[model samples]
Target: MITFYDFICPPPQATKSGNTWKTRLSLNYKGLPYKTEIIEYAEIAQLYKKNGIPPAIVFPNGYAHHTLPVIKDDITGHDVFVVDSLEIAKYLDKTYPDSPRLIPDVEDVDAQIQEFQNQLNGAVIAALPVMFKASVPHISENSQAFYKAARVRDLNFIFPDKPISSLDDLQFTPEEIHATWASLEQGFDGLSERFGGKNTFRWALGDHITYADLILAGLLLCVKAVHGEDSPQWQGFMTWSDGKWKTFLDNLGPYLSEDN
Candidate 1:
């Protein structure tokens, strides 16, 4: 049986960092039988030492790397280790080669696929620290220092560091949050134009879900987690491009059977 070992203090439900959910999405897509081992992110160090991590699929033949979404082929003793979600999808595309193709045609859609991956990774990484810090319960001086000087090697000042305690005290002030949300709104709106409208039966590119949809779903879940689903910030953004985004999710639903 295949096993997925993942982090626990997961990101927004059904988000990428929620490795369990990510694994589930792929596993279900392949209709594979698997079990999950949920461990705290802190425990990863220990698991790695033991080499029992699931992504490092340990088959009858040998062991694999400690990556997420690893699939152990007990039959041929093949241990497939896939790290990136997009790579995992591509691997599935190759292995299955039928039913749900997670990518577009190689010759025709490779450039677009690369573009979507680039934009998704770059934009999300840029926005992540802000979103993560904003979701904390209470921002500490150390936490504030970490984020402020995050891009820098070090902060000029130091405070007794402690985990964030409250969500309300996240880095941004109410004014700052509002401003940031406005910027995100504008960016996503412009982004919608480039990708086509949300829920439009067209995924980020045109027609059919791909890596773009997976990454977007993960990122959107992050945004929705920090900002309530009903928040004015995300309200207009989700369905803006003629409900195109919503359409993508509608079609992609079965891929994430449990989540939807």
Candidate 2:
């Protein structure tokens, strides 16, 4: 069995991180048997270091950030640790060639799909202020402190026009919220056009599903998880781009199971 590492969010929110969801959805799609090991946000770095797992990301300032969606696979009769969602997906595809490939063997296909995922991620980041605000109430105090500090530290880059020193700065004005939503909508529209426009295809690569489609679904799931299905934000999102995203997610229902 594979050991999947994921973040532990409090009640009312299930599997909050899109990065983790990418791996989770990939595992489910490939019919892999795995057990989840939930870790708190504050414990990530320590846990990784204690286990001698290398950092998943190293920032320009030399900060080694250890992230989740990590996996320990022993099916090949050798223990191997894979970090990062994309890497995990590629690893799974290479290890279990008999399963449906998430990262196809076609030439340059993986690069193209990664670019598509990057575009979708831009939209998700644009809507972070609102999503993060909604999530604050549901996370633990330790996570709240950790996230707040990290956001505040990176405020200049994310919100250069409105520098902030605290999480209270996220109390966005009505105009600010409207502007962010507009940016997110525009981002979605651009992505939709790239894949033959809204309602044109069931998946990113026509009839077949790939990591690209999973990338889109994971980000959409993040919004639903944070805003709740009944929230106005989520309700409005379901109708955006001619209901393209909603239909896409619905088609992926079989692979969206929460159970491992």
Candidate 3:
């Protein structure tokens, strides 16, 4: 059995973080028997270090220090840990040879998926904070401060040219919010080009759900979780994206985890 780590949000088990969701997508797709261990935002770095999960060779955005979606299991007769969502997905596939792979055995798909994910992550820089602001209700009161500061640091500031030294200095006015969402809309539009078209295929690459699909699905889940799927903001976002995000969910239905 594998123990997956995630962030515990409000409403208890209602929301899951994207970093963790990506790993969950792979684990669920592989049909692995795993349970989640939710961590609070403020203790992320300490908990990750306690588990002997080393810091990433190159730091990634959206993580306070150590990223989640880590897994602990006894596959090799002794317990072992794997951290980072992509690395964890690869680890699971290698360790469990019989399971369906997130990355297929096709030529150039790996590189292409990697490139797609990198672009998506970069694009998220625009709207992630806007979504995060709307989703603050789910974060624990004590952890909110840490979460905000970390986001500010990761985003460089709530708005460019305005310096933000801490959570207190952060600003998210209506104009800034609109600009952020505009960035998100543009980001998705750029990514949609790679698909050839909405009618091209259900998945990002081809017919099968590859890592690229899981990566996008994880991000969608994160946004949905934060903004409350039923909230006006989420609805507005769906409208802004021209239903592309909803279509993504519809296609990903088959591969998603049961609870998800």
Candidate 4:
């Protein structure tokens, strides 16, 4: 049996992280059976050493590593570690070829498909500073360093600045909140133009649902959660243009809904 180490913040129930969401999607798609070990960020040190993080697979040997879509083959006693969401999707396709394929094999079809996946993953992660900084008071230094290094665009980019820290304090006045909201709005707008417009795309690249759809659907919930339902920040960008995700989820729905 595979043991998955899971984090409980950002309210996992409310909005599962890209890593967790990707794992669940793949597991569900593959009919994999696994167990979960849930822990708060502050307790990660005590839970499974300081390096523990959800999406990580704990082997029978008790070793834990940062991996997403991790799989432990109890039958063979083999522990597989997969990091990136796209990589996980591809791994699933190769490992379980009979499962529903997320990305088609044709090179021409795939090139376009990958573009949208990049936009969804890259654009949403462009604001990693905001999320990581907010998690500072709760997580360990190793986790902070991991996120800072992972998110650095260039050598000089120092994240967790005083201004960014201020937002975490949650003491902002209306003006400050508006300013912060404006910046987030602009950021999402840039992402929308690059990934969500009519010509921007349905799946990040073409019309079919691929890794991009899973990424977009997950990130959309995060964005919607941040910008209140009443806020005009992403009013127009809230819904997928063609209702693809809605149709896919149908009764279940991809988003967390405005009421959440």
True lDDT of residue 238, candidate 2 = 80
Question: Candidate 4's residue-wise lDDT over 1-260, tens digit each?
Answer: 64555545443244334455655555555555557655554454454333333534454656454433343334346665445566667777787777677767767766665666665545444355554444344334435454443334211234334333233333446676456545544555555554445443434444554565666565554454445446565464444444333333442253323221
* Among all candidates shown, the one with the greatest lDDT: 2
Candidates 2 and 3, the one with greater TM-score: 2
lDDT of 2 by residue, 104-132 (tens): 77889867886777777776676776766
Q: Using Cα atoms with residue i matched to residue i, what is each candidate's TM-score against the true structure?
A: 0.66, 0.90, 0.85, 0.57
RMSD (Å) of each candidate, 1 decimal: 8.0, 2.1, 3.3, 7.5
Question: How do all the candidates rank in terms of lDDT, highest first?
Answer: 2, 3, 1, 4
Candidate 2's error at 255, in angstroms?
A: 0.8
Off by over 4 Å in 1: 10-23, 52-75, 108-110, 121-126, 137-170, 198-200, 228-244
**What's the count of clashing pairs in each model shown?**
18, 0, 0, 2
Report lDDT (Cα) of residue 115, candidate 2.
Answer: 76
Question: Candidate 3: where are CA atoms >4 Å away?
Answer: 57-64, 108-110, 157-163, 196-198, 239-242, 258-260
The candidate, 3 or 4, that scores higher on lDDT is 3
Better of 2 and 3 by lDDT: 2
Better of 1 and 3 by lDDT: 3
Tell me the whole-model lDDT of each prediction, alpha carbons only: 0.53, 0.81, 0.74, 0.49
